[model samples]
Target: MESAFSGHIYRQNGQGVTSILSRRVEGRLMWKQRIIGLHLRSKIDHSYLSQSQHADTKGKSVETALHSLVGHIEKANQYGDFTMVAFMDIEGAFNNVDPMADVEAL
Candidate 1:
């Protein structure tokens, strides 16, 4: 079978070898990305960093963050305390980084 990503032909043994190989490649890529993400996130000083790529982190997505924020607001309202919120979009902030530099930094 021909691999769509690599454009290389792979031998099959009637056991979905192509599918297995593709999944293996994807797993390795995810692992590498996770390692790089962890290394970069370590430099952040904020204790509330909730990047979803980390294996141990939960409630790291925007939906979960918003849910937590709403929970906080509810708690503050119940206690008659002032609540403040600020949201910033840092999208594409790391899109310009060089892949080679990241590998070398690791």
Candidate 2:
């Protein structure tokens, strides 16, 4: 995904065009590098989690706890098979996900 543009002029009259071209090239390179890094990190994280015995046990425990909690809630609220559900949304959730910025700040 890396993109770059270069222009050579016989004279110095095309400074504006050169500047714009370099900026665009650099921007594309930055985006491509970011995407590659993200993909690599994701793959590494998935590998680590998949190979970890502790993660598997933790996941099972979490699922069991959630099932127990739901069962308890259902028993406590016996309304003839009718149940209620609540959902909440947080605004600017993605805006808070600056992983690099957070690492740099830390």
Candidate 3:
């Protein structure tokens, strides 16, 4: 098993202003003929930290969420059973995600 953490910077505005920061930590395990990969991300949450009283609150929330997700993935990796394969593909991971629509009468 191997794990790595990486940081990335992106320019949000057209004027080359880069204000947002993000990071990702990935873990992988190779067994026989297959590999299992897990990715965790850190993103800036502006909603909870905009006000003076809420400063640092967003960081705490994101940290907790990432911790919980990583724990769950670790548990699954320890208990899940599977056979080794030569190839794997993640289909419709990003493009298929849809936001919930309010279809009822408003």
Q: TM per model?
A: 0.42, 0.28, 0.22
Sort by TM-score, best first: 1, 2, 3
Number of the top lDDT candidate? 1
lDDT of 1: 0.67
Could you give me the TM-score of model 1 versus the true structure? Answer: 0.42
Q: In lDDT terms, how accurate is model 2? A: 0.55
| Superposition error at 100 for model 3 (Å) | 21
Clashing pairs in 3: none
List candidate 1 stretches off by more than 4 Å. Answer: 1-59
Q: What does candidate 1's lDDT look like per residue over 1-106, in tens digits? A: 9755765456677675466566778899778777877876565455554452333354366667677778889999999998988766678656556756865664
| Per-residue error (Å), model 3, residue 103 | 21
Clash numbers, per candidate: 0, 0, 0
Give the per-residue lDDT digits (tens) of candidate 3, residues 43-91: 3334534343321353456557556556766777788944332433468
Which stretches of candidate 2 lie above 4 Å from their native place? 1-18, 46-106
